[model samples]
Target: MVRIAIDAMGGDLGPRATVRGTVEALAANAELQVRLYGPREALESEFSRLPKRLGADAERLDIVHASSVIAQDMKPSSALRARRDSSLSMMLDEVASGQAAAGVSAGNTGALMALSRRALGTVAGIPRPAISTAVPTQQGGRCYMLDMGANIDASAQRLVEFALMGEVMARRVDGLARPRIALLNVGVEATKGTASVRHADALLKEMANINYVGFVEGDGLFSGTADVVVCDGFVGNIVLKASEGLARMLIERVQATFAAHWGSRVVSLLARPALLRLRRQLDPVRYNGASLLGLSGIVVKSHGRADALGFACAIARAVQEVRIDLPRHLEHELGQRAATAPVALDRRGSGVSPCAKTDDFNS
Candidate 1:
């Protein structure tokens, strides 16, 4: 069975959402097992309320008692020093101890990244972990983007590392043979971006295995122009949050337009199915999990405000990564690149900085 661990008290809904998601995940996949870490009373209370039909699935579920929880506003440093007994920490402990293949949480993003790095460490030659997730493309495909806010400032070399990791993620998770990689910039020209982007572009062009496809602008993110888009955390985080906001605005406007008049209402009745599909396509909840790529173990962070179904989607993401053995593949890929090109593989740990808290639970 593929065993996964969860911080049941991590999100805004706490055990109310997590326990339900756990039971749902367990019921959906017979080969999956779960280790839920949270207060014993809370977990038991939630589980007891779930349908009796899921009782059979509960056989593979285990609850590990955790005494505390890390608050959403807690700093990563404080959490590391004072919240060792927190559910988030305990969940990562299960993964680090080899009792679980992967871990999932909807807790403080900074805390998760800090604790995970200390507990699981990063893969060799990787300075730090990058937050990555797939976004829907106009072509009905998905494009993977990284540094969604793991590190605020990344060097040219760090951008290169993100590129390599994102390429691997697209290939392994999406089954793309040679994912088209691009550097996110202001314009498609080599001379259009900052010094770091320009430098990284030069370096990527020299790497034969990377399949580098020059630069991609912000508009290109949804244009099906590239499979992997690499950028610093500052730019990437803004792009992600803005894209989500824009999607919500557009969807709401469309719905409002459909309800404006009797004539439109009649058409809306006929077009309901297509509109529902469009909403689902743009729903950020469907893409809830963000992988902490480059870590030695699998770690997925769910949006803190996510509902039960969204949390369940996060759990599913961890299971997929566990089965794929993503870290191993990343390590092997880095090793191969280093053996062939020494300059491109100049890897060194740039030690963790004080993790910054964001409005959303993302780092």
Candidate 2:
């Protein structure tokens, strides 16, 4: 059975949303187990109030008492340092100790990233772990965008590495055989954007390991020009937030338009089902969150405002990631390339560049 450690004290809804989501996930998958980490009394009290169906499944649920809880406003490093027994810390410990295959938290993003890095460690050759997100594309497929907010300022070399990692993830998670990658840029031409983007583009085009499709502009993001989109954290975060806001605004506009006239109301009555379907298709909660790739173990971070259903989806995503052995696949790909090629030196001449070993560079 796959086991997951959940930060029960995290998120706006606290134990209620966490416990409810866990119960929902358990009900959906009987082979799964959840170990809740939080204040013993608080967890127990929440468990007691669960529906009879879930409360009876308590045998499958375990609790780890964490005397302290980190608040959303608390500084990540300070909260992590001051609260040794916080729920997030305890859950990460379980992951590090191999007690759980993954950890899920709807907590402070920075804290989760910091704690995960400290506890789980980064995969070999990965400079910094990236927060990868899945966005529905206009071509009826999903594209994986990486470094959403994990590393605000990444080197051109690091972005190249992120593209490789993102390709591995998209293939493992989405089963893409030849996942095409595009460096997010201001234009489709090879010459575009800042020095970092242009440099990364040059490197990507020459990297034999990835299916580099040159540049993809912001408009192309949803147009499905690429399977994996790589950009610095600052740009990726802005794009993600903007996409989310745009989706929300469209939903609100549709609602307002329907209420403005009686004929529209009648149309809306007929369109309610379709609108709901579209809403589900674009719901941020349905997407929930993304995995923190480049780590030894699976770690999913959800929005702090996520409700029970959203949290449940995040849990389900983690389960799928574990089932696919994402980390192992990445290790195999990186290792195989390393074994077959001459070591490419970095600026410091330490080792081979990540882009040097792959056999798919564009002429």
Candidate 3:
């Protein structure tokens, strides 16, 4: 059975959401098992109310006591130094110690990233973990984007690393062979983007493992231009959050349109199936899990305030990663590829530097 560790106390709703999500996930996947980490008494209380809800299937679950919880806004350094007993830390420990295949958390983004890096470390070819999530594309395919918020000031070499890592993930997890990878930039022209992007572009074209497809502008994100998009955390995070906000605003506008009058309501009724499809396509809950790629162990982050179903989706994501054994594929495959790749030149056109050192990055 694939075992997952849940940070039951990590999210906004605590075990109320976590336990229910666990039951929902467990019911769906017979091969799945979970270890919920939180305060012992609190977990017990949550379990007491779930007998009818989960029935005897609750036997598939276990609880591990975690006495503390890292605050939602807690700094990563503070969490690492002081919150070892926190549910988040304990969950990571389970993965690090090989007791669990993966860990899921709806905790502080910074804390989770920091703790995951410290506990699981980085896989070969990845010095630091990058936050990666899939976005719907115009071709009805999922496009993977990375460095969502992990490293704000990512270097040109670092961006190259993200591309390599994202490429491996797309192939292994999504089963894409020779996936089209692109750098998120202002324009498609080689001379249009920043120096770092331009430099990374020059590097990617030479990599044997990646099918680098030049640059993709913001509009290209939904235009089926690339299967994997790479960017620095600052740019990627803004793009992701803006897209989410825009989705919500458009949804509200659609509701207002459908509820405006009897005539509009009639149109809505006739278009119900299409509207439902759109809703499902754009539902934030469906895209709830973001992988902390490049880490040695599997870690999926859920929306901090996600409902039970959304959290369950996050749990399901961890299971998928475990089944694929993503880390091993990345380590062995990318590690071998990096060993033979040419050194990437910096803006100064320097051939080698400490930042581009492949030892730690491709370790």
Candidate 1 vs 3: which has more TM-score: 1
Order the candidate numbers by TM-score, best to worst.
1, 3, 2
Looking at candidate 2, the ten consecutive residues that score lowest on lDDT are 354-363
lDDT of 3 by residue, 1-363 (tens): 999999998677878888888899999999998999999999889878875767667778889999898888666666667758989999999999999999999888888887787788777636666888888887587788887887777778889888988888888888887889999999998899889999889888877756999999998778888889999988888888888888878977897898798899988788778877787577643446889887889999987767788789899989999999999987787667656654752223221112221212100
Error of 2 at 339 (Å): 5.2
Q: Which 10 successive residues of model 1 have the least lDDT summed?
A: 352-361
Model 2 spans > 4 angstroms off: 338-363
The residue-level lDDT of candidate 3 at 239 comes to: 87
Candidates 1 and 2 compared: the better one by TM-score is 1
Provide TM-scores for the models: 0.94, 0.90, 0.91
Best by lDDT: 1
Which residue ranges in model 1 land beyond 4 Å of their true spot? 51-53, 350-362
Candidates' lDDT values, in order? 0.84, 0.78, 0.81
Number of the top TM-score candidate: 1
